[model samples]
Target chain A: MIIDGLINGIALGCIYALVALGFVLIYKATHVINFAQGEIMMFCSYICYAGSTTFHFNFILSFFFAVIAGFLLGALLERLFIRPLIGYPILPVVIATIGIAMVLQSVAALIWTFEPQKLDPFSGSPYQLWKVSISPVHLWTIIITFILIFLFSLFFRHSLVGIKLRAIAEDLIGSMASGIPVRRMYNFTWGLAGAIGAVAGILVAPVIFIHPHMGSIGLRALPAAVLGSFGSIPGAVVGGIVLGVSETIAGLYLPKEIKDVFPWLLLFLVLLIRPEGIFYTYEQKKV
Target chain B: MKKIKVLAIVGLCVACFLSFTSNTIADTGVNKKVILVGGSLDLTGPAAFMGQGVKRGINLYFNKVNAEGGIHGRKLKYIAEDDGYVVAKTVSNYKKLTLKSRVFCLLGSTGSVGPKALKPYLEEDKIPLVGPYGYTSAMFRPFHTYLFNIYATCEDQAKIFVDYLKTELKLENPVIGLLAEDNEIGQDTIRGAEAQVKKVGWQAPVVELYKRSAIDFSSQVLRLKAKNVDALFFPVISSHSAQILKECQKANFQPLLFATATATDLRFLKMAGDSAYFGKGLRSFATQINHRDNSSGAEEFRAAIAKYDPSNKDPNSFNLFGYGIAKILCEGLQQAGADLTREKLISALEKMDGYETGIFAPMTYGPNNRQGTDSVRILRADHNKKDFVIETGWLHPE
Candidate 1:
């Protein structure tokens, strides 16, 4: 039972981690929280559904279609909503993201009509690893998430665009003085986050089913980002895994009524001890 | 000359009194030309499918009746406000409908919580709420005089499930398990199942409760598997039920799964996919006949949809329910006679006995009975045909 729980938790954690990575990416590069990350994921899932079911595209084509659409959507939203509020207070920027979330959710609902849709699972059946049963979709989610994390790590460390974005994150005014295209970098960062969200959405849709309000899953992933110190990419992954595994384990052993709240409970305990989180070190900003 | 003047003045005063008394007896929503009905529906939220289906169904029946010259030379006008499944919004909409729109009565409002919240308002205002779409026993248990329930309570369905397991399946001593949402509906299901178990002198079944927003059911399924129960009663909505079925398939736990009428839809088959096609599939208790069935009521409903709502190429169970309930309300309206008032409508509905709407079982209501039906038929999903087939005749709670 414990092993099965662990495997299930890890698979579930992969989805949360992928979504949390979107949050971390945006926050790191732009210092703005993307509250609509879940809605982006939901909308992209619908795009994938439209591609596969409506246009009769194959799996690979549908996947690329959704990811590319998500990139453009992210870039467009930043250009329109966020860029206008660039010199405003941080609160207004956060509120604008929230407004964007509502509009995206309402638009998706109008287009899809609140009907939950099905996506074909990645594979036919579950594989039996001794006593633990793992579905192919879940296996693919774990594999794909890890691969994306690796690629992202390499890009941030080695690529010039990634370095430029990180430099903007460190000192926005300094990067502007150095003649870096900060606005374009911000746009690219949001696009990258959106593409990652699309991947997360398509993978999780088969497991959870697709709906306009599936973006509520974003609320769950927010805690994951917070637990990972809000801006650390690797911390997001570790925090998501810890939260998921502990939640499943608690559900297994504890009372059934407390299962949903166990994640928040664990987060509270962790925050009480190490406010900086497990993977990230927090430095107090001297304002 | 003075005597003639006094007689004329007295006759005019008597005529004036008669005119004022005649206007006082007429109701607020019913005028000489039309009868206005209103509803607060979840037309844009999670339960939008249900709200929209019920709305469309009600409109189909209303249009049919209106084209037939309406009841007693008055047209039926239905106005629905979107509550988005929120209880507070439902209350506000109820106020708006009653105070501003001044609808004659409410028909087919969606969600258990919304109707439950509107009970106080219904009672205080002395307005009738006909054919509310919910399964919570609270709609009828204490018998709110103004609230008329059209469907069987979830408790009634649960009892019928237990009875089926004992008699038809012959699982007299089999271990039973229940996985239900943690709400009034879930509580009612537990109460009914436990009541039946006690009556049959069988051991108590295992119970698991989950929130409505919960996405995963791994632990619940695992616990049920560990218990090795023979049959599981899960009276949840269709989408969540599909998720549970997937979890069961992944765990390789194949128990006889029973659900409520809400799962007897094509969407369940779509969401569950092959898991629904495997083994015996899912058996559920249904209040209305399936739309795909060849019964006279179903055929009539389909034909009506084709004619009245041509855009609705595929109508589901919720639409059928809405159509059936609208029929019942129309029946009540007809029975209330031309002198319609809120009290008259209530009396008319209470007088209904063995009134067959063709889509539903024989509905019987009395002074104390607000629940329209107490019987339900069992249905099994056939994924190949993408529809549900009747498994049993009308089964009643034992």
Candidate 2:
């Protein structure tokens, strides 16, 4: 049972990692939180479902269409909503994202209806490793999350645009003065975050199924973001895995009602003990 | 200017007097033209789909009734408020609907927690709550005068599931297990299962309750497998049921699964996907008859929704429940003879004995008994047909 829990925990942690990457990407680039990350993920998943079911696209084609849709949606949302609030109070921009989340959810429900729709997993068969059984979806989620993380590390460290995004995140005015298109950077940040979240949603949908409100699961990833110090890309992945394993092991020992509380409890402890998070170095911000 | 101001003030006072005195004119949402009823539903919550389906079902019946000149010249108007499945929100909606809107009664308040929270206010106000969609045992045991339930308690369904396995399936000393939600509904099922375990001399079932949001059921399934449980009693919604069943199949653990009505929805099949094979032949205690049952109620519901609620061409279990509740409520109102009061409606509802709601079996309620039905039919999930098949006629708990 513990082994099974460990496997499942890792699988769930990978999903939370992908979602945390959504938060990390937007915050790391723009220094503004996108509260609508979950809704964007949900919308893109529905697009994938529609692509497969309505448009008769194959799974790969469906995924491609979803990622493109997610990118466009993020770009459009940033252009329409976030750009206006640039250089304003961070709190209001955050508040505006919450509004965007609500609007996006309502729009998704209107388009797709608020029912749990099914998406076929890419490939899955119960496989055994060392006499312990693991689900195909869980295994695939881990594989995809790691691949994305590897690609992300290379993109951030080696790619020119990646350094530009880092520069924008560190000093927005400095980047703008240094000839980096600040508005374009913001749009790219939001778009990339949306695309990353779409991957997570599409992968997780096969396991939990798809619904407009399924995006609420994205909220669980918030603790992962916090644990990863909210800004560190690698921190999101590591923090997510730790939180997932903590919950699973907690379930093994604690009563079921108390088990779900483990994630929030961990979040509190992290904040109380090391608010900088496991993978982050705290730096003072100047006004 | 002063004279005009005095006239404006007099006009404002007159308007206030007319609005405040309007209750007497309508007699608390009842009038010669319309009767305003209310529903505190989870129309925009986690269970929003269920709430919307039920609301559509009820609206189908109401729109049909209204088109046919209504119940004795008074049109039934159902105003639903979205409570988001929160207890406090349900209470707030109920209070606003009753105190401000002066709605006559509440139909199909969404979840057990919401209804359980409203018990005190219900007792205090004495507003007859007809067809509340919940399965709390407290509603039945220490029965509230105003809260009239539409279905058997979760405990009743649990007992029926166990009894069916014992007698009909003939499982001699079966090892039963419970995978339930951490809520009153889950507790009720556990209560019934525990009682049966003691009665039949079966070993105590390895029980585990999960948070409503917790989708991972691998550990629970593995735990059940380790215990060698022959049967698992489930009291959860369809989405969670699909996830759990798939997890069980992935682990190669198959047990005789018996779920409540909520888990037996056709929606589960769609959600279970290729993993739907695991749900094959799974059983559940059904509240309303299957849409494919070819019964009069099924036919009527189909025809009604087709004409009145065309959007809901394929109504699920929630829709049927709403249709049944509306049917019963309408009958009681008709029996009340157009002169409806809280007391009168309560008396009329209490007098129901073997009253057919077209969807459910004859539901009888007495002064001491407020439950709509104590019987449920057994349904088997048929993945091949992608629908639920009725396995047995209506059977009560032994």
- Lowest lDDT sum, 10 consecutive residues, model 2 chain A, at A120-129
How well is each residue in B213-302 modelled by candidate 2, as lDDT tens digits?
Answer: 785777677778888888887878778888877887777777887777776666776676555456334787888787766899989888
**Candidate 2 has what TM-score?**
0.90
Which residue runs does candidate 2 get wrong by more than 4 Å? A123-125, A128-130, A169-177, A267-274, A281-287, B1-25, B67-69
Each prediction's Cα lDDT score?
A: 0.87, 0.84
- Candidate 2 local accuracy as lDDT? 0.84
lDDT for each residue of candidate 1 in A1-287, tens digit (9 for 90 to 100)? 78878887888888899899999999998889999999999999999999999999998999999999999999999999999999898999999999999999899989988988998648456789888888787789889999989998999989999899888988899999999999999999899989999999998898789998998888898878989988888899988888778777877889988999999988898889888766676558999
lDDT by residue (tens digit), candidate 2, A17-132: 99999999999888887889988999899999999999999989999999999999999999999999987999999999999999988888777777788886554558888878
Write out the backbone clash pairs for model 2: none
**Where is the poorest 10-residue window by lDDT in model 2 chain B?**
B272-281
User: What is the docking quality class of candidate 1?
Assistant: medium
Output the lDDT of residue B132, model 1.
Answer: 88
TM-score, model 2, chain B versus true chain B: 0.91
Model 1 ranges with Cα > 4 A deviation? A282-287, B1-27
**Per-residue accuracy of model 1 over B227-342 as CA lDDT, tens digit each:** 98789889898888888888887777888998888788887787888777555578888888888888899899988988889999888888888889899999999999998888
* Cα deviation of B343, candidate 2, in Å: 2.3
Q: Residue A143 of model 2: what lDDT? A: 93
